[model samples]
Each structure stands twice: as C-alpha cells, then as structure tokens.
Target chain A: MAEAENKQVIFKQYIEGVPKETDMEIKVSKTELKAPKGSGAILVKNLYLSCDPYMRGRMRDFRGSYIPPFVPGQVIEGFGVSEVVHSDNPNFKPRELITGLTGWEEYSLIQKTEQLRKIQQDGIPLSYHVGLLGMPGFTAYAGLYEVCSPCKDEYVFISAASGAVGQLVGQLAKLHGCYVVGSAGSNQKVDLLKNMLGFDEAFNYKEELDLDAVLKRYFPQGIDIYFDNVGGDMLDAALLNMRIHGRIAVCGMVSQQNLSDAKGIHNLFNLITRRVKMQGFLQSDHLDLYPRFLEDVTGYYKQGKIVYVEDMNEGLESAPAAFIGLFSGKNVGKQVIRVARE
Target chain B: MAEAENKQVIFKQYIEGVPKETDMEIKVSKTELKAPKGSGAILVKNLYLSCDPYMRGRMRDFRGSYIPPFVPGQVIEGFGVSEVVHSDNPNFKPRELITGLTGWEEYSLIQKTEQLRKIQQDGIPLSYHVGLLGMPGFTAYAGLYEVCSPCKDEYVFISAASGAVGQLVGQLAKLHGCYVVGSAGSNQKVDLLKNMLGFDEAFNYKEELDLDAVLKRYFPQGIDIYFDNVGGDMLDAALLNMRIHGRIAVCGMVSQQNLSDAKGIHNLFNLITRRVKMQGFLQSDHLDLYPRFLEDVTGYYKQGKIVYVEDMNEGLESAPAAFIGLFSGKNVGKQVIRVARE
Candidate 1:
C-alpha cells in the first residue's frame, strides 16, 4: 500500500439561498492509495467531475428530498469519470477506467460498485462519459422518449436549451423530426443552438418581456411537447401556449432552487383546458434504458447527427466555482471539472 | 305547427369574477314547437338541466378555452334531459326521450342533432340521465381509470369530495380496492362522505386551516392518487404530500374559476422530487369509454355497490340561482334544475 496527499473540495455548511464559492473549502488530506482488505471497495483516481443543477438541492438542509443533503464538513460527492487504482471487488480491476459516483478529490474509496460501469477507452473522449454519454444525456433520452413521447413534426419547446440536458433534448427531438425551439439566457448560446446544434429556432429569453406572447410568436400552432429545465415564469408561460394533449417533461427547476419560497405557477388552469400531461422524472429511475441510450446517442455522435458542447474547467480546485456557475447560466454548456489527465 | 310561450334563461353579460343570480335573466319568448322541414333538426321540450361547475367558464369571454363562451342576451346552453316534440331528423323520432345539449328554455329547436342521443325509458328516473349517468359521472370514470390508473390498496385522496365528480371518483376508487379519503367544505358533506358514501376517511377542509397538515394527518404514508376538483391552496398542499410516483388527475378547478387571476401553486417543485404525474383531461375526448362507464356504473348502482346524490331545483327559473350557488359550494351533490317531469 502507498500513502499520498488527496486534494478535496469540502461542503462547509448547508445553504439557504444561492450557492457561492465561500460555502466550500479546499483542503489536502493524507490517504492510503488502496482499498481496505476484504472491504469489497475499489479506490479510483477521479479524471473529470460533472457539475449539475441538481447538486444545488443537496446543499440544503432538507431531508424530504429524493436524495439526501450533503453533510457539513464532508467531501462533496458527484458524478465523475475515474480510473481504478486498487480493487478488492471482483468486478473492478486496477488501471481500468470507470464512470459513476465518485468524489470531488484525487481518489475515492467506492463501496457502491453496483452503480459503477467499466468504460471502454475507444476513440470517444473519456470526458464525455460524464457529459454526453452519462447521466445528463440519459436524462434527455428518457425524458424526450418516455415522458414527452415525441411524434414526427410535432412542436417542441425547451427552456435552458443550451444547458447539458436541454441541448441533448433539442438535438434528439430534432433527430426525431420535431420542429424544435429553445430558450437560452444569452445570445451566444442562441446562435450556437440554431447554427451549430441545428435547433429549428432559438431565442434569448432574458430579452423577452412577455414570455407568453414570445412563445405564441415562436410556436404559432402551440407547443406539443415542453422539456422544462428551468421552472418559474417560463413554465407558466409555456402552460398557456400548450396544444391539446401536450406533454411537459419536468426535468430540473434550477430557477427555483435559489428562492426560499419558489415562485408560484399561475397558469396551471391551462393544463385542464389543454388536456396536458406534466410529469417529473429522474435518469436513475430509468437506468434499465441505459444500454439503449448509449447505443442510440453514441450512434448519433459517430455519424455526426449530434454534437455535444462542454465548458471544461481545469484542476480540482475549480470544482466549487464550476458547480456554482450552473445556477447563473454562466457555463455555456455541460460544466465539467478536469481533475487529472490519463 | 303549434305556438307557445318559451320560458328561457338569458345570459345577461360576460362575467369577470364569481357569477351572480343577476348575471342571468328569465325571459318569455314566442316559439313554434316544431322542427322546420329540411333543417334535419329536432324540437325538444326541456326536462332536466344540469348546473355544473364548468359552466362558470362559459360566463367568461375567453375564446382560448376548449368550449366557447356563452353569448350575452341569448339562451344559456347546457346538458339536459328532454322529450322530442317534433323531429325532421331520421335519427330521432317524435315523442322519444333524449339527453344531450339543449337550451335553458321550455322549447328548444336543436340544429346540431349529431350530439343528441335517444334515451330508453328504463325503470330509472329520467333526471338521472342529466346526473349520475351523465357528464359528471363519465368524468369521474375516465379520470379515475385513465388518468389516475388506480391500483388495489393504493392510498387515494379526493378534494371537493361531496360534489358530483368527486363523489363518484371516491366511489369508483373504493370499488377498485383503494383506500379512499375525501375532503369537503362543510362538516355535513364530510358526514355524508364517511357514513353515506362509504369513504375510508373524510375531513372538512374549512375546519382545518392548514390543508397540508390535514392531508399529512389523513394520509400518513402519502397519497398515491389525488383526484383534484378544487385547485387552489388545497392543490398546492396536495403537491407536498404526494408519494413517489403519485398520479394527480386534474378534473376541474372549481376554486379558480371564480377568480379573474387564479391563485398560484407554490409547491409544484414537489412534482420533480416525487416524480409525480399530473394530467388534465376532458371526458368528451374519451367518449369511447362512455358505453363501458354506463354499463359498469349502472351495474354498480343496481348491485348496491354505489350510490348517487342529487340536489334538485324546481322549474327553469331556478336554474340561474342553482348555477350561481356552485361557486359558494352551496349544492351538496350533483346540482340539477328540474324544468319538467316526464
């Protein structure tokens, strides 16, 4: 066994409002670079860490949520692309690349090997395992296919359209022959959505005064499917412009996560008049479709039918800032922290 | 052709807030009680007129809704049980009993005969055609079976449980072997729900100021199915107490119909955390299930497995007050105006 210094980002305390870099502290601790004997654990050195909006929920002190809150003074845990260094578990071996739940540090002693999957180092970038081929991509797939049930030529609208999940969702819907429209916070993201990602149309929602009128203008016939990543006034606006039997996939509520009392949705009555179906889902719950998601998304990428955008932050020290940047729409696309090179 | 004075209820004007008795005026007009030749129409003598909560929506001058608004200074149109006095349409013969769309008047010359259906003079009361076996009943059937998709022994909750749709929904959920709980505005309605309607538990929402606490008390394990007829604070509260993968059937927003601006729902974020599915539907869209509903419900009534309650108002002149009373939760069950007898 070898001993080493592990650099980590620690959750300093539970937060109330929007997260800031001050809420986390960077520390260096000594650790044995080996899994304990007969512990059924595997130690892995993290390569890349994913920054997701759902992580904001873990910063709160609420116990009623689906995932437990991050404990004060503990190393912040998140999804990451890692390489195995030591293993006591039979399924994982030393030097094998894997992706699943890891740490915001140099190395993690993972006891939950069930969630980890062995990553084949093909031509595809290993960093994509935490972005396009990971949880966010699978989320887009399950939500668009299972929740929205997209039909050919149907009108689809997505908010936070340039974000990790929304970008993938728009591309998938486009590939499915839907007339896709997306709303982003900046004009740069909007330009990328239309020119680079091939969305039918894109708009900067920050410049729009009346979202309802804006939606009506973009979707003259009304939206048949709405992939909602930002839930607030945008959700209320989308509600009023839904076509009959429309489906809304409630993916993430990044806009409401900061407010102590979330903004009230006033136009839900439209849900009845339009006969809409609004459902919330998680990617973990639909892991049974993971194999299919990997096949379809990878196929699309290889054929150049789909393209992924990542905002890579170099070094483990950038983890807290990268995670915090997701709430403000500061990250242009999928936010990832590069911990170490292969 | 025969001449007669047709007593009719005229919509005074478009309403902004809650409906008032003065919003409608009773007028007597001359009429020829015969279907004109080549008109393919039927002249019917009105019997029973249903006063539904959804009728309030028609009082507003909104064209975006599924149904059109009521024309001011004209006869109010609604579902009714009638007798064909004269018929030029081959589908309906003279002197046959029927139920369908009809005017709030003594004699109605219905031009759209496509929506009309001839009724059999079964041993059941003719008024039941506008009530337990009519739109409200079918709404409960479709929302329960199709939207909620109840499973045996699942915890079910119904808001506005003493009203027409809620009462039937509670009964059907009970018949499906679900644990049913209902909430009503008055203690009397709660008594009726528990003792007469055979609900597992019943509560008076007015008595409990904290709706979320009351729901938590009644549904300790959280509600699996929520049949929501009232969509205000109760709906917001129900969102907080839903179980994982809960289904919420949005039947009618009786609570919101009266307001110019509906109250905002603040707890919709729970939809994501719980992975709940909330759907809005119209019974008219599921007419294919009507025959099945009629068979099942009629059989349940005959077998003493279900019961229906009606609050009947005598004469066509009473229609205005009965319809207005719905906003105040005045009617105890299915509200009906008995225009005439068979």
Candidate 2:
C-alpha cells in the first residue's frame, strides 16, 4: 500500500503557566495503512477529536499526577472517534467505528483493543462519542448521581456550567426535580444555561464580586448538592452555603489549574460545621457504570430529554487554537474538532 | 440550709484572637444546696472540667457553628465529671456520680438530666470520663473506624499526636496492625508518642519548616489514613503524600482556629489526583456508638493495650489558665481542672 500524509499535533515541551497555542505544533508525517505482523492491533482513521480542560494538567512536568504528563515531541492523545482503516485484531474490521483514547493525528495504529469501544450508532452523531456519550458525559453522570446522590427538590449549584461536563450536570439535576443553579463566565453561557439547559437559575460569575453573597442570594434554603468544577472561591462559598449533610462533588478545578500556585481555600471550616461530604472523583473510577451510563444518556438524547451543544472547529490545523480556547472559555459547549470528513 | 459560695468561670466577652486567661474570669456566686419544686432539674457539685481545643471556635463571634458561642457573663459549659448534690428529677439523686455537659464552676445547677450520663466507675480515673471516655475519645473512634473505614496493614498518620484524640487514634491504629506515625507540637510530646503511646514514629511538626518534606520522610510510602487535627500546613502536606483511595478524617484544625482569617489550604488538588476522601465530622453524630466505644476502649485500657495520660491542674480557680494552655500545647495530655478533688 502507498503511504499517505499524516497530519499530527505535537507537544513541544512541558508548560509552567497557562498554556499557549505556540506550545503545540502541527507536523506532517508519512504513514502506511498497515498493522504490524503478529500484532493484534488495528489502524484507525481519526474522525472527531475532543478538546478537554484536563489536557492542561498533562502538559505540566508534574511527576505525580492521575494521568502521566505528555512527553515532549510526541503526538498528544485524547478521547477521539475513529474508523478502522486496517485491522489485525479479530474483534475489529475495516470501516468499523469505535471510540477511545487516540493520538492527535489524522491516523493512528491502536495497540490496545480493550481500550476501544465499538460504536453503537443509533442515529446519533459520531462526534457525540467524544462528548455527551464520552468521558465528560460519564463524568457528569457518575459524579452527580453516585458521588453527590441528589435528592428531589434539593438545591443544586454547579460551577463552569457551560462546559462539556457542567452543561449536562445541570440538565440531569433539573430533570431529576432539583432546583438547579449554574455559574458561567459569560452572559451568553449563563443565558444558555438557564434558558436552553433548563437550569432554574444561572449567573455570570465574572460579574459577581462576592461569590458567597451570590450563593446566599440564589440558594436562600442552602445548597444541598454542589457539582464543583471551578473549585476556588466558588468551593469556599459552596462550603459556607451547604446545608447540614450536604454533598460537594469535586469534579475538576479549572480555576486553579492555570496558576503557578493554586489559590488557598479558606472556608473549609464549613466542611466540619455543616457536616458536608466533599468527595473528589474521576469518571475512570466508575467504569462499572459506563455501560448503563451510555444507555441512559443515549435514551435521554433520543427522547430529547437531554440536548447537547457542541462547538466545532474544522480540520486538523485548528486543533491548537481549539485546545487553548478551553481555558479562556472561548468555546460555548463541548469543544470538538472535525479532523476529517468521511 | 446555708448557701455556699460558688467560684464560677464566666466568659467576659467574645474573643477574636487566641483566647487568654483574662477572657474568662473567676466569679464568686451563692448556690443553695437545694433544687426548686417541680423544677425537674439536678444540682451537681462539679469535680473535674475538661479543656478541649474546640472551645477556641466558641470564642469567635461566628454563628451557625456546630456549637453556639458562649454568652458573655455566663459560665462556660463543657464536659465535666461531677457529684450530684441535690435532685428534683427521678433519674438522678444526691451523691450520684456522673459526667455530662456542665458549667466550669465549683457547683452547677443542671436543668437537663437528659444531657448527663451516670458515670460507671470501673476503677478507671474519674478524669478519663472527660477525656478517653468522653467526647474527644468518641470523636477519634467514630471518625477513624466509621468515616475512614481503614483496613489492617494500612499506613496511618495522626496530627496533634499527644493531644486527647490523636494519642488514642495512634494507639487504635497500632492495635489494628497498621503502621502509624504521629506529629506533635513539642519534643516532649513526640517522645511521649513513640515511647509511651507506642507509635511507630513521631515528629515535632514545629521543628520542621517544610511539612511536606517531613511527611515524605516519615511516610516514604504514601499515607493511607490521616487523622488531621492541626489543619493548616499539616493538612496541606498530608494531601501531597496521600496514596490512592486514602482517607483523611478532619477531626480538628487547632492550627487555624486562632487566626482571624484561616490559612488557605492549597494542596486540595491532590484530592482529585489521588482519589482521596476527606470527611469532616463531629462526635455528637455518633452518639449510638458510645456504648460500644466505651466497652472497647475500657477493655483496651484494662489489657494495657491502651494507656491515657492526664494533665490535671488543681483547684477551680486554675480553670482559665488550664483552658488557655491547650492552644499553646502547654498541657502534657488531657488537660483537666480539679474543681473539687474527690
């Protein structure tokens, strides 16, 4: 078989502060559509790429982290939807669609077949595999349902509400009869949260000077479940506003990730005073729930009980800007890149 | 009957900074050796008063805390061992020894018999009822076994190791066949922890400037269970050295209590990265466990498996100084005042 040009996004080096677009570069390489002999691996043609906030952590030189730091001069990997171009694995074949952690390139030779989940296309968009039905979606699902364990009519406050995970959390809690309130960076995101995502209340956190006052204003009855994504002053405020036996599900701390030194959290005293249960969790820990999560989230999407908003940047070269845009809240929804059109 | 003079410790006013001897005053008041008709109350001659670190939080003007702040000019209330001088209630009678929430005075007119527990003197020192057999002991017990749910062979680290709760936690973890390390405020306390309390290793946290480095040295292997008593830099350091699925029971934060603005905790990122569960708890939440805890601890005490150290200050007039000594780590062990020696 003749070689084809493989366009790849490569990490130049580890980052110290807020990552810039210059930190990543697009490199063109040659690839033959083949898997190694005696290797039970498949070659995949990348379709959709996911740009997530967690990727920033992998860019750091930190040794002890949940995910290992991305090696310099290597193609960064993330949750991507792909099609089998060639296969040596018995379980997969050419043109079979799957979703898993794949390289930031036009093509990849996947070695771990166990990591790939054969795509179940029930008239759903393939891009959704890296989003509402993917890691971010499952994170929202398990963190809220399992970790927070929301009760009906309880007050639910979510930070970073317009992000991939936060948007879904608000919708899920709202559907469960919770009085859902969300905080976003922009007025548009806040509007989308309240008007489109069906959140009972939404606010632009940037506009609010005092987070504690804002929380007290919206949640006069006190917050019962806090889906913490921003995790700084919002967490402090949430701690103060939590009712007795309230739960704080620590999903992500996007607010603190960019700074060289994380901001100190001061209102932890409320954790004891309110008997609040603050649990930090990863969706990977709840893998046993994925099959059910996929099924439930799929049903919600089809019945229009849940709606996903995705911001798409076209082509492989747009990858760097799309990824960097996440930190600044530049993207409106689940930030996705259309790597190629089948 | 002739009324006796009552030497009572009264709260002068709410304190913003660390409480001092002057914050409380010894006032002489008249007390009759009688109970009012149909009052359904009991009059107790206070014997021993327990000085706990949690009282510092009560000194603040902050409302909505676990326990309400002490009213100005009222006798400060705490766990105390006493002899019932007179009773109008059927449950308690004159000369009945008991331990309950009582005022820091030579004599107390207790209105609620429901709050009192009739002391079961099993040759155990009456002082133990306010320390190992009282709120602090139960706080350590319920927080570790119930909240942490620690397994055998795990690595446990307890802060404020020589304090009333920490000393017991270290011993309990040792009995459970776990490797335990403890941190104290002074060299003398550290020696007591290793030599007398049977801790595997103990360090004076004040001597070490880098808390994270000190924790890393003691726990070369990551910490599995951290009973956090001093919750400023120590809690921050514990977060950095926590193993996956580790548990941190937030028992107290005496380090942060005195400061008007609590020191910011910065290493909470480790919570998500390590999948650590940090729970803040109260002893009152586990009142049902009191009977079981008392039996188990008493057994451990008798078998010489557990030993408690008491730091007793003679006379009711010394109550203010003894209580003030706790914040400075001046007391050797469970600080108690001998209101009227048995």
Candidate 3:
C-alpha cells in the first residue's frame, strides 16, 4: 500500500446564523490510499467537489432534518466526482470514474458505495457528474415536471434563476414550451439567464424592493408555476400573484438558510384563494426517474436544446469560501471545486 | 301572481376587519311570490341558511378570489335549503324542496337554477341539508380523503375541531383508522371533540399560550395529516410538528379572514425537511365525489357510526349576529340560521 498526503477540508463546529469561511479549515493528513482486503470498500482520489445549498443544513447541530448534521473535527462530506485507485468491492474496478457521497479530501475510502454510480464517459464533462448530471440537475427535472406539472404556454417563474437548480428549471420549462421568467441576485446572472440561458425574461431581484409588484409586472395574468429556490420575501410575493390552481415547487430556501429563524410568509392565504398546491421534495425520493432523466437530459444537451453553466473554483482550499458564498449569492451557476484534473 | 312582504338581511357596505352585526340591516320589502312566465327561474321560500367561514372572503371587495365578493346594499347570499313556491323551469316544480345558493330573504326569485339540487326527504332532518350534507360537509370529505390522503394508523390533527367542516374531518379520519386529535378555542368544544366527536385526544388552543408545546403534548409522534381550517398561529405550529411525508389540507383561514393582512408563517422550512405536502382545495372542485360522499356519510349517520352537531339560531333576525359570531369563535358547532320549519 502506498502512503500519501491527503489534503482535506475539516468541519470546525456546529454553525449558527450565516456560515463563515472560518467555520471550515484546510488540513493535510496521511492516508494509505488502499482499500482493506474483503472490506467491500473502494479507495478513490477525489476529482471535483460540489458546493450545494442543502449542505448548509448539515452544518447546523440538528438531527431532525432529512440528512444528519456534520460532526465537529471531521472531514466535511459532500457529493464529489472521483477516480477509483483500489477496490475490495467486486462491483467497482480500478481507474473507474464514479460519483456519489464522498469526503472533501484528495482521497477517500468509501465503505458505503450503494448510492454510487459509474460514469459512462459519453463525451460530457466529467465534472458534470456533480453538477448538470448530478443532484441539482435531477432536482430541477423532478421539481419542474413532477411537482410543478408545467403545461405549454403556461407562465412560469423561478427564483435563484442562474444558480444550479433554478437555471436548469428555467431551461427545462422553456423547452417544455412554457413562458419562463427568472429572478437572480446580480445583473450579470440576470443577463446570463435572459441571453445565455434563453429565458423569456430575467430580472435582478436585488434591485427590486417590492417583489410582488415585479412579479405582477412580469406576469400580468399571474404565474401558473413557481419554482421557488430562495424562500423568503420572494415566496410570499409569488404566492400573492399565483394564478388559479397554480403549483409551487419549494426546492430550497437559500435566502433564509443563513438566518437563525426563517422569515415568515404572510400570503399563504393566496394558497386557498388560488387553490394552489405547494409541495417540498428531495431528488433522492425521485430516484426512479434518474435513468429517464439522464437519457432525456443527455439527448437535449447533445442536440443543443439545453445548456449547463458551472462556476468552477480551483483547489481544495477554495472549497470553504465557495460553499459560504452560496448564502450571499456570489456564485453565478453550479459552484464546483476542482480538486484534481483527469 | 301573489304579493308578499319579503323580510331580508341586506349587506350595508363592504367590510374591513372583523365583521359586525352593523354591517347588515334587516329590510322588509314587497315581492311578487311568483316566477315570470317563459323565464327559466324558480321562486323559493328560504328555510335553513348556513353560516360559513369562507363567506368572510366574499365580504372583501376582491375579484381575484375563486368566488366573487358580495355587492353592498344588496341581500346577503349563502347556501340554504328552500321550498319552491312557483317555477317557470320544467325541471323544478312547485312545493319541491331544494338546496343551493339562495338569498337571505323570506322569498327569493332565483333566475340561475343551474347549481340547485332537489332534496330527497329520507327521514333525515331538513336543516341537516344545510349543515351536515352541504358545502361544509363536502369540504371535510374532499379535504380529508383526497387532499390529506390519510393512511391507516396515521396521526391526524384538526383545527376548529368542533366546527362544521372540522367536526366531519375528525370523524372521517377516525373512521379511516387514524389516531385523531383536535384543537378548539374553548374547553367545551374540546370536550365535545374527545367525547361527542370521537377524537382520540382534544386540546383548547385558547388556553395554551405556547401552541408548539401543546401540539407536542397532544401529538408526540408528530402529525401525519393536518386539516387546517383556522390558519395563523396554529398553522405555523402544525408546520413545525409535521412528520416526514405529512400532508396539510388548507381548507380555510378563519383566523386570517378577520385581518386585512394575513399573519405570516415562519416555520415553513420544516416542509422541506419533513417532505410535507401542503395543498389548498375547495369542495366545489371535488363535486365528482359528492355522490359518494352523500352515500358514505348517509350510511355512517344511519348506522350510528357518525353524528352531527349544530348551533342553530332562531330566525333570519338573528342571521347578522350569527354570521358575525363565527369570527369570534362564539358558535360551538355548525352555525345555521333557521328561517322557517316544515
């Protein structure tokens, strides 16, 4: 077994309020770089690390959430693309590319590989296994189609529009023949949404103080489907402007995730007035659609019907700032850390 | 044609804040108690008029709601049981009993008779048609069975548990083998929920200062289905105590209807963590189930498996006060105004 220095990002302690870059620290540790014999584990070198908003939920000392909180003084765990170095599991082979839950380190010994999927190497970017083809992409697919149940020419609104999930949701709604409008934090992201992503309309949410008036201006007839990523004032505004029998797919609450307590939504009465259906879903629950999602999304990407954007940061040391930047809306697209090149 | 003095309750003006008895006035005017020849209209004598919480929405001058608001200086309209005095329409004959939308007057000339249904005298009390077998009862059926999707042994919670819709919702959940708990504004209503309504447990929300703690005390395992009738603080409390994959049926917002601006719900992030589905539905949308509802509920009542409770007022003179009392939680059960008897 060859011993090597494994560079890692470690969780400092349970977080409160907004996460700071100091909450995580970079460290170097010795690793065997080998899987134990008959241990059914695979040792892999991490390639690309994903920074997702849902990861923030893991930083708090709350056991009641879908995923458990990160332990203090441990390697931070997240979705990552990796290349296998050694394997005791018969199913996985050496040099095979895979993606699933992995530690934020240069190398990791994964004992639980049930959720892992082997990369097909179909000319798509390998880093996309953690972005466009990963949880965020799948979240967009499930939330829009299954939860929102979009119809052709129906008015659609999305928050966090240029980010990982919202960007994909907007593109998919456009491809579905929906009149898609998106709101993003920065003017650059807003420009990207309107021009680059082919959204019907885009606006900088940071510039709008009254979201209700802005939503009404964009959708005079009222929004038929709202893909809510940043839940706060925007969610309340969207509720007031929903058309009859509207559907709201509550994907994430990026804006409220930083606060110790979430902001209150005053317009839920609109749910009854509009006869709306507001549902919260996780991509993991809709794993049955993964195969179909991969096939459809891959075909669309190849035919240039859909596009993906990534805000890639260099090295493991940048992982903390990149993850923390999510709360402040700093990243434009799928935020990923490049740990190693293929 | 015969002439009669029509005693009516006229809505004085569009209301703001909680409704008051002064918002309506008793008016006596002459009316021709006969339908015009060649006109497809029916003349009816109003019998039992139902006072519903949703009627408050009609008081506000808002056109975006599912139903249009009430026109001031006109007769207040509501669901009522009536007897046909004269008819020009072939479908309806004189001396026939019916249940549908009618004015709060001694005699009403209903021009649009499309929604009217002839009531069958099956040894059941005629007032029950406006209480247990009317819109409120149907709301309970559709909201509980269709929206909540209650499973056997699941925990169920109902707000305003002794009210028209909530009483029926609690009973139906109990029949479905769920462990039911209900919250009311008074100890008497709580006693009615536990003993008379057959709920497994009941609590007085007015007595409990901390709604979250009270909910935890009642529903230790967390609620699987919450029939939210009075949305505000209790709804926020229910959101925090929901189990994984819980369903919340947004039936009405009696608490919010009083306020010009609705109260904000702060714990909506739990919807994502618990994977909860919160849906708003109207009973009219589920009318296809009405036939089945009539059959099932009628059988339950006949077999002594279900019971209905009513808070009946003496006459149309008490209609204004009875309707206004709903906002203050003064009525214990289904609030109905008995205008005349068979």
Best by DockQ: 1
Candidate 3 - CAPRI tier? high
Determine which window of 10 residues in candidate 2 chain B has minimal summed lDDT. B254-263
- Give the residue spans of candidate 1 off by over 4 A: none
List lDDT for all candidates, in order: 0.93, 0.91, 0.93
TM-score of chain A of 2: 0.98
Cα deviation of A273 in candidate 3 (Å)?
1.4
lDDT of 1 by residue, B106-168 (tens): 999999988877788766678878878999999999999999999999999999998989899
Per-prediction TM-score, chain A only?
0.99, 0.98, 0.99
Candidate 3 Cα errors over 4 Å, as ranges: none
Instruction: Give the TM-score between model 1's chain B and the true chain B.
Output: 0.98
lDDT (Cα, 0-100) at B196 in candidate 2: 98
Worst 10 residues of 3 chain B by lDDT: B257-266
How close to the true structure is residue A153 of candidate 1, measured as C-alpha lDDT?
96
Q: Identify the superior model by DockQ, candidate 1 or candidate 2.
A: 1
lDDT of 3 by residue, B1-342 (tens): 789999999998887899999999999999999999998999999989999888888988888788999999999999999999999999999999999999998899998899998998998788888878889999999999899999999999999999999999999999999999999999999999989999999999888999999999988999999999999999999999999999999988899988867768998888888889999999889899999999999899999899999999989999999999998899999999999887
